[model samples]
Target: MTKLSPETILQHACIGVMGLDNNGIIQYINPRAQELLVCDTHNGISLDTIAPQIWKQVKTLIQQGMNEQAIHIQGPRGGIEMVVSPVDKKAKTSSDNFNGVVCFLRSHEKFESSAWQYPTIKEMHLQFQSLLDHSYYGIYIIDGNGIVLRVNDVAAGLIGMTKEEMVGMPIGELAEKGIVDQALSPAILKSKKPLTRPLYVVKSNKYIMASGMPIFDKKGDIRFVVVIEHDMTIVKELRDQLKHARQVADTIKNELSDRNLLELKSHEVIADSPAMNQLLTVLLKLAKMDASNILITGESGTGKGFLSKFVHQNGSRKDKPFISINCAALPDMLLEAELFGYEKGAFTGASNTGKAGLFELANNGTIFLDEIGDMPFPIQAKLLKCLDDGEIRRLGGTKSIKVDCIVIAATNHNLEKQVQQKKFRQDLYFRLNIFPVHIPPLRERREDILKICDFYLKRYNKAYNQKKRFSEKCIEQLQGYHFPGNVRELKNIIKNAVVIKENNVLDTVLPPGKNKAVPISPPCEETAAPPASKGLNEEILAFEREKLTQALNHCTSTRILADYLGVSQSTVVRKLKRHGLSVE
Candidate 1:
């Protein structure tokens, strides 16, 4: 038999063969090598540019001083295997004389051998297994045919099975066997892309987030599916618990809000009328919001002060101090010192040890500035600064003390009109009016009048230990009257009636001739007084007749007469009969 030449043998060889110089430049590549590498160039080309994956493994081996030994590497293409061996042209005995390398490539389908026949392949497999075993999260790898090629210890444990029982099993079988909730690798193969889904392991009773990524071959075919599963049982439990807690908190808040609205009467706030009730509803929500600056506007004696306190009591700062000050009651200089506080020896009558102002004293609470419309212009500027910056300087000190209190200002005067008249600062008004609450006067919410009257009647009745009850006529008179002083006037009238009434059934509360409306004139010259000389009883009768005549002139009917005289209809008729008076 004749020995074939090296070039003829290489050309006829079934496996791929390539030669590289010391510089890693392809010196020669057989036809089979070109086909396997998908390279058109035959020579003088860098191996790094042609087969980068193979070059990487070659560089790794060379760096490890193992280039002389034949080593097998898993090539870039799926099922493509490579063997790299250092070439010594001068002598085959030592690698010191090696100047180039020869690479033998073969398809894995065509190669069959034992572990010892390819030590590098066995070592690479061991390295891969070691990496998978060391991972904290479950790692599962499947071949393109949906068969499990390898699984980490974590993955096997999560499935409640051993690595031996899982390898070579199809992914679909895991779901059908009740091992996992569903197959995730199939979706990755279908989309040829990564997919993430929530998964449940039946055996372990654990929730997991499985992220599947597809490994594709150079031909863009699915090569393998890699799935990483992270346990989500604790996170899911925490999220559910948080959601339940929030729902419970919301229910409690709603119940408390309704209860607070109903208990407004206990706070001495009468909101029975639709107008006042609506206002209270808004105030309740504002209180819950913990509004910083709120302005209460209404007529005098309409209970602005009570409403201010109501807001403070229901708010988040209920535990803090509540300091109230009447702006109109204090002089300018004294008011400033009282509000912002004064330093020691700051003024002529300053306190010896210095005093904290209402604002400072009311820190982290609420400060009710009653009659804020009457606050002096000079002090309004400083108050505005405090509101804007949340800090106030002492009356005569240089340092600013920070205050975190809610400022609720109440005013009977029309602040908008005052602002236009230049009597109040417009900016300050805007600041305080961020959340405005307008209490309707007694006349506007007349329905609340009877309720307020009854409340005060009961209060005063208890306080004075009296069982005096207003007669039907008296109730009619009280309800019909146009209260000029609002609730305050009503309260005082009820207190006086409950305290001074001699009989259990009180008939008259208002003075003899005082009417619901302010008199057009103080009682004409004739109705004013009887001549002192006329006897006492005769004088009393004459004066009563004169006031009756005057009331009759303005009142057209029995109801009108009763309302004008501040008496019930029956009282008016009886008084008319005694005085010989009648409506035409």
Candidate 2:
């Protein structure tokens, strides 16, 4: 029972070991330590040079006479745990004595490769079987011949088969679920590369994405194929939802377009006064003519564009393309390209295949130029040329293409004044003024207010799928207001009311304007005073008279006044007669 010496112990131990003196120099090195450190002998190598990071801590322990301690060290090869213990207590005679520190080294847990080594083939098989039974992702391994060597529990469950039944089956059998074609296995075998594709498990009624990668052996030859399958049922469901939403949006768009067409067809120019009727007659006549270049002038939101469209749709070009372009919507270069086609490689980032301008697209049709006054002078010249001569030249191309399109210009500005100020071309203005169609403002067409409201109300009701109707009071309030935004403003008001109003009640929270509702006061108590004091009925009559007077003063004609009052033109005339007033 003799105690083994340090050398004898080191010879038998598997791990590396070395002893260091208090000066941080390697005093002893075992054969295993030399091999582990990748050094022959500690001839010129010091403990600090071999492991500087750990030596610092060791020096501190030695200086303080610390007891047994251990530290984890990282090296180029791998990680190691080093233990230091003092051999003798009085060996440090003057801090440079021959006293030694015994060092024991062991490989780190992660660096110890012995865990991967199986004692026997039976042990390795059991470990693989256990992993295959518990993995959530469908796992399968195939040999070089595309034959399945192993199948996991998840894979067996996905294909509605037991692991024992699926094992040793051809990999092609799983790929034939009608998700991917039958040629996928042969392709993977030929290419020896990874393949990924979306597939559905017919038996489980679930979608899955399958990926297979080739495993190469030490000779760089394909040894096996590892396939992983992920379920994609939620992803497919989300995609379907997005597609349904787009379809619903398209349906709504088509319905809106149909409603707009119906409204235009049923609309009538309602004006009882001679002056307004004369204007409407001229517009209607011009709308029917094919040669007139109509210029519609009005204030912003005053139905200039709407009337322009009405003219086009009712004209001889009704079957042709009715293209509308806002002249002021874009900058000069973009607007030029939009109107004129650009050649390939004309400028940086230009479309490689080039583009066709709007003018060419409007050939054999009619082009409605909205905000004509806002078009740049250079583009205006081109437009004038296109009108005089039926030809257009692309941005960078030399060829001039012939066009047969009618031009319909619309504006909210006075083009005559623009022409005088040299802002607009006089010749262009005269060409456009062949037939002038002036759309009177909302304040001038009071007779059409309620009609327009009813139209808009029905439109919004169908759009929102709600059963709502406007009350008589709501109609009266709408008619009484001066719509500065014109027909467009009226349409917006009706739309907003439709959204806010519930159960057929119009919300009174109107947009900002003089037409906003004023709070009315209750009738005052009649006191027994002099006979000269006006009665309640008389006072009410006076109030009504004053309102009628004010409305007539601000409006263009009686028809407008009647519309604002939400009453018939005859009622307005009768009221005017009773008050001894004339709508001048």
Candidate 1 regions exceeding 4 Å error are 1-140, 144-195, 199-208, 216-222, 230-238, 257-267, 270-292, 313-322, 330-366, 376-406, 443-454, 468-484, 502-584
lDDT of 2 by residue, 30-123 (tens): 8766666666766435778876777787887788776667776775567777778776856653345438687777677633466456466558
Which candidate tops TM-score?
1
Clashes of each: 0, 2
TM-score of each: 0.54, 0.42
Per residue, candidate 1 scores C-alpha lDDT tens digits across 119-165 of: 89888888887888888899999999899998988888877889999
Deviation from native of the Cα of residue 219 in model 1, angstroms? 7.0
Among all windows of 10 consecutive residues in model 1, the one with the lowest summed lDDT is 518-527
